[model samples]
Target: MSNISQLCVILGDQLSADISSLKMANKQECLVLLAELQDEASYVKHHKKKIVLVLSAMRHFAQTLQAQGWQVRYVTLDDPQNTHNFTDEVARAVAEVKVDEVLVTQAGEYRLQQQIDSWQSSLGCTVRCLQDDRFFASIDDFAHWADGRKQLRMEYFYRTMRQKHNILMEAEHPVGGQWNYDHDNRKPPDKSVPIPPPLRFAPDQITSEVISLVASRFADHFGDIDPFFMAVTSEQAEQVLQHFITERLVNFGQYQDAMLTDEPFMFHAHIGFYLNCGLLSPVEAVRQAERAYMEAGAPLNAVEGFIRQILGWREYVRGLYWYHMPDYKSLNFLSATHDLPAFFWNGNTDMHCLSQSIGQTQKYAYAHHIQRLMVIGNFALLTGLSPEQVNEWYLIVYADAYEWVELPNVSGMVLYADGGIMASKPYAAGGSYIDRMSDYCRSCRYKVKLKTGDDACPFNYLYWYFLDKNSELLANNPRMGMMYRTWAKMSDDRKYEIRNSANKFLRNMS
Candidate 1:
């Protein structure tokens, strides 16, 4: 048996070379453990592509550590002796290697964090759970910023992060004399504009093996495993980042909110898949976008918008997740109880917007934020889908989704199930918003212009339906006053038609 000083556990998501536990370890004395466990893979029937991405990334990262002179213990999912759980694997490793301590970065999800919390008593060793410093704001840092604030807004938190990081700052003011250029950035998709495809990497030998394993074992999973083009290593991930900075950043902000049919990767960075998994650093991605602006390679709207997603929204959701967790998972501020529609799994819906968004997700395990937030997520919101089911569906579908980031976005932003904690008002919108923002409505069977009848867009009536049903909860909200006033002015017969249309749609869905 090798005499090891510590067993450093690097999780599937914690694949970064600069992970805190790895940095704290004496590479010569500590054994690095990277395991592909069945339990984690089967927890929610994750997309096959997501499973392959994580396992392949983990395997590649293990090789990187070994080449760097660290002793590594790699466990494959198909290994005969695998216990398919973290605690059991850690115990087995502790028994095999003479180690005095177990060092690990904090788990990204609350359920996993509970298991990590028990390692000391169960493993009978000193278990050190280090803060994941990859993020700009630590859990404590966010809590401090959130403390005593009646309203927790991403804009204020984002300004603080920009100032703290000196990202777009010139002394006390922003470079463009504005913290946000979103007004300049929301031009609807111009079909005439040239759109570059996201950079795709051919699967290497290690990733090929992972694809084969996931294809067979998770044949029933949500997404297609093959034709997998995700970057599985840091070098490849960096290539993706550089590709975005050069090719996509200039138009990323302008068309960020716009959606086009059959054009899945239009002017989007597609780096969230890499950034969330620790294959690429968020700070590095943010800095590169800033540099592009400084070099006149990309516009201020593009650079600032891209940086805000990572520095502001990404960090904010993570902080909110940790701060409100355990109980945060169960929040149902709207008391929504509808089961997730079966269409979410297979993209079998008449709404072209949803079908396009979900179909893209199933094919690639990727969807840009607008598709997620406004199309698919907005549908879930208006339909009164159960938050738990909605949250699980999101976590299962996206490669970038972990509960820490996914839950807050779904519960608070999408479902409004967290009340007003994450958003001032629900992001509910009618088909007019979709028609204006996307090309999906042009092809949709539902009439985007109609407000009632079977052929009318479900989103049109459902938007009013959601507001009416939740008026007791949302009526007094300042941001919702205009929407309520619009509703109030409608003739009683008109209101009845909207409610009836929504009811019929909900019934048909069930």
Candidate 2:
């Protein structure tokens, strides 16, 4: 067995059998190491389901490795000897196994990657962090692509990725004459449209045990642990992909940006939990959507928009995260410093949209994109919630959140905290946008049409208030100029009323 030639460290996120660290590992010589670390599970108070998902997937992956004849050393969270962090575990493994080298897939988080990079010299053994090949773009590849670009726009980067990967392409041209179908994909949810609940999986013994462990250990965590139905293995994740393509993909684009009172899923493929965990490959997911379009006659708009998310926005965000992290996480362009309202965690609010979105998040650890952007995120931006607080809340609440993906989306796109890296302007909206796009306003306790009264929806006045208060920082922005002009043209009395209402709400927000 070459006297423990290598110790292969598999992280919770790096569960794929085809992960780079495993590609050259031999069953006879390599020892696979999987540990449930308290440090990771407790970092930022992850959603209960997220913890269960990762631990269950790690256990199943370890079992899969053993079935393939690889020598596996698995450490449960409750292991009496568990030191509760990666570095200590790795140190113990190297000493006990007498391995000459360590092999690991590059960690998704920058902090973890820095630690892995430090291991070789510290451990006195050769440590290799193989490039994570699950992504279509390598870190270096994205860096090279991003070199010297004046503005890092997703649309341009996405187009380049399409050409490089030859995805949805015909010869040298894109399959469609145009690059984006986003305009066509913004239709409000059709109440007449019958939305199927996403496919659910009953927990097996492995997952059931994980649920118990997470529940008892993380009882104070942000989200609910019971009624757990997420796919914890690649096989089950594939079933989710199949369900999305066959049943929901056709209408996914049409209702992609829509939200409703009780409809959280709304034709949105809830497969991000799978995709971010390495259970589903981004390339394979997009290719399936493309195939569905060509073979099953799915609309081009639906297929293109779905493909754009995985191929375009997902890849673009990851690249941006790696390109400007550590610094990126701290950017707060507008100096937003208000504490996040407690209602975010407990969902105790009179606003119907916030109540529904936050309630669903607590229950399922999922919310569709628009609900995230226009509801929770928009409210955060308009109300001047601290970027760090808002960013951490997003990281804490979602099952699919890892720092790389969650940081960019929250700090850049959601809050415009990176100044304009992910967006030209902050996605600041009022109740009108929510009312038009969702059914939440129809039944809201706050009247959507009232702009300044006690019964007025907070969003109605908050939207105008944000524009006026941030005029110094945002007025010169070309995209924001029109809103500034509208604010400029408003009667002084009306403006005073709006600003006063917003200030009153802000002062009382807790």
Best candidate, lDDT-wise? Answer: 1
Candidate 2, clashing residue pairs? none
lDDT of 2 at 354: 96
Instruction: Provide the RMSD of all predictions against the true structure, rounded to 1 decimal.
Output: 1.0, 1.0
Candidate 1 per-residue lDDT, tens place, 5-103, comes to 899999989999999999999877899999899999989999999999999999999998889999899999999999999889999999888689999
Quote each prediction's TM-score: 0.99, 0.99
Q: In model 2, which runs have C-alpha deviations exceeding 4 angstroms?
A: none
lDDT (tens digit, per residue) of candidate 2 on 345-419 = 999999999999999999999998888889999999999999989988999999999999999999998898888
Least lDDT summed over 10 consecutive residues: which range in candidate 1?
Answer: 1-10
How does candidate 2 fare on TM-score?
0.99
